[model samples]
Target: MNIIACIKQVPDTNEVRIDQKTGTLIREGVPSIINPDDKNALEEALRLKDKYEDAKVTVLTMGPPQAEVALKEALAMGADEAILLSDRAFAGADTWATSTTLAGAIKRLGNFDIIFCGRQAIDGDTAQVGPQIAERLDLPQITYVEDLEIDGNTAIAHRAVEDGHYIVKTEMPVVLTAIGELNEPRYPSIKGIYEAFREKEIKVWSLDDIIVDTSQIGLKGSPTQVKRSFTPATKSAGEMLEGSTQDKVRDLIVRLKERQII
Candidate 1:
């Protein structure tokens, strides 16, 4: 079985800061880590690799040259191979264009039993890339997967919803977007890290290397335009009501009534 896991290198949110004047992320000094949910997806792939004797897990990502760090991390966690898609033409791609590029790369990979991705990327919470890739590939997709199992060529997954989860079954060559509840990612072992850096090679691909339409990639291919990026205004502090229980209750009622919220 061939399991492909898609991951992204995102800025550590806790350390992220916005430039007050520019209203843009201050990434100069921020550290990058694998997107939290994508880590869960990779973990699930690793677990499956452990379960099937013929299973081989391959980790893939599209980012700058530095993004190879995330793939190395995946190899350190037991992925058999890693692929990086990097090219200047791929810059400023929105979800649609991004999915188009990824779909092209997946096609180049030839054969695959399953493709796993995170439900959403922290940087862009659109949550559209996975499904878009599925659509482009004309493959079935199951999102918000909390649990999953495989039987021969069939995949059984628990798809999370607002009220509960729904059981879904699909054939091989399907896409799945994993949520955090799926599994906990394992830490990289010292020996694994050494091998990943020394023995494993991260194959890099450019736009020309993959099959894709010239007009459907990079900034020119993006349909949506970001007119501006800015931070929201800071919220004001809430008022504190001072009085006895009855008095406070009466005051709250009056406030609610004045605001037409009662």
Candidate 2:
């Protein structure tokens, strides 16, 4: 079984700060980590690999050269191979363009039995890339998968919905978007880390290497335009009533009456 796990390096939200003047993220000094949910996807792929003797897990990502760090981490977590898609032409790509590029890369890789991806990336939170990639590749997809079971060529997935989960069964060569509840991601071993840094080679591919429409890449292919981005105003302080409980209740009633809220 050939498993492909898609991941993205995102800024650690806890340390991220917003530029008030520009209404944008201040990424200059922010440290990046693998998207949390993508780690779950990778963990699931690794578990499947553990089950199948011939399973090969390939970690793939589309980002700047720095994203190679994320691939290295995946390698340390037991992925058989890593591939990085980095090119100036892929810069400023929205979900559609990103999915298009990934789908093209997957086609070039060929012979994948399963493709796993996170439910969404923290920075974007659009939750569109995985489904879009599935569409572009013309493959069956199950999103928001919390649990999965594989039997021969058939895959049984538990998908979370509004009220409950649905059990979906499908064949091989399917795409699955994993949520955090799926599994606990394992940490990289010391030996694996050393191998990742010294022995494993992360193959880098450019836009020229993958087959995709030139016009439908980067900022040009992105259709969603942000009109504005700003932090919400801080809430005003609440009023304090001084006196007995009865007095406080009376004052509160009067205040509510004055505001026509009573």
Candidate 3:
């Protein structure tokens, strides 16, 4: 089985600045890390690889040149190979554009038995890319997966539901978007680190090499654009109550009513 884990390096800090003029994320000098949820997905892939010794685990990511750091991290965690899709034309891409680019990369990489993704990215919590890629690839997808079991040519997983969960099964080549609650991620050992450092990965790809249409990439092809983003101003502190419990409740209710919060 060939398992491909789609990973991303996102800004570690939440203090993202929005460029008001362009309505885009200001990524300059933002320290990035591997998406936390993707780590869980990678762990699941590694576990499957361990269980089935013949299985091959590969890590794939799309970002600027710096994103190779995330792929190396995945390598250190036991991925067999790594691919980085980086291109100037892919800049300012929204989820749709991203899914398109990733699908292209996957197609270029040939066949795969399974694909894994994080439940959501901290930077862009739209949670649409995984399902979108599945649609592009014409495969069944289980999102928000908290548990997965692989058996031969099929797989079963517990997908998150509104109030509970749904246990679903699909044939091989299914896409699974894993949540952090699925399993505990492992750290890279000395051997892993050494191997990763020595492994020469496939270099980044641009639109030219990939033969992607410039119009269908980057901000131009992105259907959804951030109209506005800003941090809300802080509000005043709450009032202090000095009375019995009942009195405090009454006062709180009155204050809530006065403030039109109820």
Write candidate 1's Cα lDDT for 1-262 as tens digits: 9989989999998788888677567889899999999999999999999999999998989989999999999999999999999999998888999999999999999799999999999987989999998999999999999999999899999999999999999998999999999998999999999999999999999988999997999889999776666656889999888899998999999999999998
Question: Candidate 2: deviation at residue 108, Å?
Answer: 0.4
Q: Write the per-residue lDDT of candidate 2 for residues 22-62, one digit (tens) a residue.
A: 76789898999999999999999999999999999999999
Worst 10 residues of 1 by lDDT: 224-233
Predicted candidate 3 versus true structure: per-residue lDDT over 51-88, tens digit per residue: 99789998988898888888888899899999888877
TM-score versus the correct structure, for each prediction: 0.90, 0.91, 0.89
Off by over 4 Å in 3: 20-22, 200-202, 211-214, 239-247, 250-254, 257-262
Question: Model 2 segments beyond 4 Å from truth?
Answer: 20-22, 236-261
Structure candidate 1, residue pairs in collision? none
Sorted on TM-score, best first, the list reads 2, 1, 3
